[model samples]
Target: MNKLLCSILLATSVSFAGLISTTDVTVDGVNTITKNYQFTPNPADLGDLSHDRATAWGISGVSLANGETVTGASLKIENLRNWELNEWNSLFIDLLWWAPEGVTTYKDQNMGYGYGKDDDYFVGKESEFGTVNLTRLNYNVFSGSDGMYANPSEGVTISLDGYKREGFNKIFPLYDVTIDFSDSELATLTSYLNDGNFGLGIDADCHFYNDGFNLSLTTQKTSDVPEPCSLSLMLIGLTSLGGAFVIKKRK
Candidate 1:
C-alpha cells in the first residue's frame, strides 16, 4: 500500500512553464496601420503630413486551461530602419487585452474595429476602449498614446531599455516590453481565456520614417497544480481499496 501510494503521488506531481508565440503577420487584419498624423511639419505639401502613425498588433487563440495562470506577457517590435539605439528615448510600448464588450473573437482586425487607433485620420468600430481621442487612448503610461484600451488603468509600465535584444548581425534591434499583470488582473485574463475569447493587443508609440517595422506578442502561462497533501490523501484512499481487494483474494 505504501509503495502504491508513493507511485500515485509521484505520477500526480506537476510543474508549470510554457511560452506561446505567433508570427502570423501576413494577414491584413492581424497587422494594422493607423495613420494619425494630421499635418507634416516639413516637406510643405509633399504629402498629407501623415507622420503621426502607429501599429497595433494582436495575437489570437490565447487560452489557459483549468488551474492555469498567465505568468507574463511581452511585445517584441523591430526597430525602425537606420534608427540607432540612441534615438530610442522617444519610443514607448503598451500591452492590452480585449474588454468584455461582447467581443467573442480576436479576428476582427478591420479598420474600424477595436484594433486600430481612433483619431481624425482613422475611426474604430468597437466601444471597448471608448472613443479614439487622446484622453481615452493614453492609459497606464507616462507618455505616448497609440490606441484605445479596455482597461488602461490596470496595466504595468516598464522601461524600454531593459528588454532590448540584438537581431541578426546586430543590424536591427528587437525591443521587448514586459507587461506585469497582478493577481486580480490574472483572474480577469484567465476568465477571458476560459470563455474562448483570448485576444491580446500591443501598441507602439514612436516616430518612424517608414512603415517597415514589425510587432509580435509573447506570453508565458503556468497551470495551478494540486497540492502534494491533496494528492497523498487521494492516493491513500485508493491504496486502502487495493489492500482490501488483496485481503479478500487471500481469504
Candidate 2:
C-alpha cells in the first residue's frame, strides 16, 4: 500500500497536460525543442513598470526536436506541474551546450515587449553570452541570482497569438498555448544566447542530462493556504478522484 501510494504521488507530481489549438505544421519530425525570441523596443514607458527600458518578446516558442512537429497537439509538461529541484545541482532551465560556454551562443532577446526601463538597453543574465543562429538562442548561468531577471517586473510575455487580433497574447480556436510558466516569467534573451537551445534533446539518448529542469515551488497563491501535509493529502484525494475514470477505462 505504501509503495502504491508512492507511485501515485510520483505520477501525479510529474505529469502535465496541454491543449493543441492549431495544427498547421506536423510537430512529428521534431528534432529539438528550443526557444526563439523577438524584440521590439518601447521608448516611452506608459505603465510605470519601474525599469530603465522595456522590450517586448514575441513568438519565441518552446521547440520540439525534429520529427516532432504538430500544431494544435495537446502537449504535456510534467516538470512544470508540481516540481522542485536541488538548486544548482538540479536546475530548472535546460542547457544546449556542455562546454561551459558564454551567453552569446543563443538568440537575442526580443526587446519588442512594451514596458519600463531606466537604462540603455536593459536585460542581462550572462556577460560573455554569445549567439547560435538567427532564430534560436541560449544563456550561460542557470541557477544564480537574477542575472537577467534583475528587475523581473519589466520583461513582457511571448505572445504566440495576439490576444485580440494583435492586441495581447491569446488562444485561438484550434490552439491552446500552454506555457509552462507565467508570461512575465523571464526566459531572457541572454540566457538563450549563452545556451543556444532550451535543452530539448539533451536526454539519455543525447550526450548529456541537461534537457530537463529542476524547480522550486514557491507560494502559488497570493495569500496563505493549508499546511504542506494537508495540501498534499487534498491533492492526493483530488488526483485519485480525477484519474478514477481514466484508470477504470484502461482496465
Candidate 3:
C-alpha cells in the first residue's frame, strides 16, 4: 500500500510539472522573414510637414498547444537605415498592433497608410505599442551615446551603432533593435495569436530612405501546471488515504 501511494504521488507530480519551450515566429520563410520599405519626403504635404507611413504584416504558422501559456516574447529588427538629406531631420518610429478590423497587408493604397491630421490616421483601426525616436541624423559618427537613441519610456532597447552609413549615399549596415515584451504585453500578444489576428505595424515619419529589413520574433511558452488549490486538495486526499491504511493495518 505504501509503495502504491508513493507511485501515485510521483505520477501526479510528473503530470503537473511544467515544460518550457521556445518558438520563433516569422513571415516570408522559416527563421528568415524580411520586409522592405521606402519612405520619400512629400514636399507638398501639409500634415506634420512630413509624410508619415504605416505598414503591417500578419503572423501565421503559430501553433500553440491547448495548455500552453506564453511567458515571454521579443521582436527583433535588423538592418534599419536612415537616409535623410537634412541634418536636422529626425523621425519617430511607432510600433503598433493592427486591430481586428484593420487590413493586414497593403490594400487600396500605393504606399501603405498615410498619416493625416489629428488621430484620424489611426482612429479605431490600430493601437500603438511603443515609439522610438531617431535622434542626431546629421552626425555620421557611430555609437549608442551619440548616434542611436531609444525611448526608455517605451521599454525598448537600441543597440550601439544601430545607425550606419557607408561612403556618402549608402546607409545600409548591419544593426539590430530588439523589443522585449513585459508580462502584460505577452498576455495580450498570446490572445492575438490565439485569435489569428497577430500582426505588427511599423509607422514612421519620412526620414528612413529605401531600405530592406529583417524581422524575427522569439516567444516562450510553458505547459500548464496544476493549480495550488488543486494540489493542496490532492495532498489532503492522499494523507487521508495513508491514515486510513495505517488504521486498517493496526486492526
Candidate 4:
C-alpha cells in the first residue's frame, strides 16, 4: 500500500507544468493600454517622490492561460518605503484581485509625481479607493533574514526601523501574497483567459506610506489529478475496508 501511494504521488507531481510571467504594472485600476511602471529603491533620489505617493500598484495580464487550470498563484512585491515618523507602528498591507467600474485610462509619462498625470484615475483619496476593496489572500511575512510565517493581522506588517530622509532601513524583504481561489473563482477565471486581463490591488492603510513598492505576479498550472495528500487519504480508507472484509471471511 505504501509503495502504491508513493507511485501515485510521483505520478501526480509529473503531470503538471509551471509558468511565470509579468505584465505591465498598472495603478489605481487603470489598465495598462500603452505602458506600465515599475519601482525600485534608490537612496539618492527624494526629489521624485511619486512612487511614494501611489496608494496601490498592480499588474494587468493573463492570470491563467488557455487550457490551464490554476492550482496555485502568488503575488510578490517589495515594500520599499514606509516614511512614517513613529517608531512603534508597523505598516499593514492588503493584496487583492480587483475589477473596475466602466473603462478608464490613466497615463504616466515619468512614473513619478511631477512628471506623470492620470486624468481618469479612479481612486480619489484613501477614503474613496473603493476599487481596491472590490475583491481580494493567504499571505506570509518575512524579512531578509527571518523565515516566512503567517502574520496575525492577516496582512503583511513592516516595522519602522529607522529615521526618515537618512539611514532609513526601508528596504523590506519580499512580501509574498498567496492567491487562494475557490472552486467558483477558478471557474470565473476561465472567462478572462483569452483577454488575460485581471486587476491586482494593494493597500497600506496608513495612506501616506503606501508607495515605492515593486510588483510581480505568478501562476502555476495545477493538474486535474488528485493531490498526493488527498489520494493517500482515499487509499487508506479503501485499505481499511479491504482489511475488514478479509477478517469477516476468515471468521
Q: Number of the top candidate by lDDT?
A: 3
Instruction: State the TM-score for model 1.
Output: 0.34
Count residue pairs with overlapping backbones in model 4.
Answer: 1
Q: What would the per-residue lDDT of candidate 2 be over residues 79-168, giving only the tens digit for each residue?
A: 111011111111112222111211111222232221232111212322221211111111112343221111211211112221222125
Q: Per-residue lDDT for 106 in model 1?
A: 23
For model 4, the stretches where C-alpha displacement exceeds 4 angstroms are: 1-58, 63-66, 79-81, 87-195, 203-251
* Top TM-score model: 3
Measured on C-alpha atoms, candidate 4 has an lDDT of 0.32
**CA lDDT of each prediction against the hidden true structure:** 0.31, 0.22, 0.38, 0.32
Candidate 1 yields a Cα-based lDDT of 0.31
TM-score of each: 0.34, 0.16, 0.46, 0.33
**Candidate 1 C-alpha lDDT tens digits along 21-120:** 3222223223322111111111211111122433222233444545544544332222222123322213223223332211111222222212224432
Residue pairs in clash, model 1: 40-49, 67-224, 112-125
Q: Which ten residues in a row have the lowest lDDT in candidate 4?
A: 5-14
The reply for model 2, stretches above 4 Å from the true place, is 1-20, 24-47, 51-61, 67-119, 123-251
| Cα shift from native, residue 129, model 3 (Å) | 12
Q: On TM-score, who's better, 1 or 2?
A: 1
Model 4: how far residue 4 lies from native, Å: 53
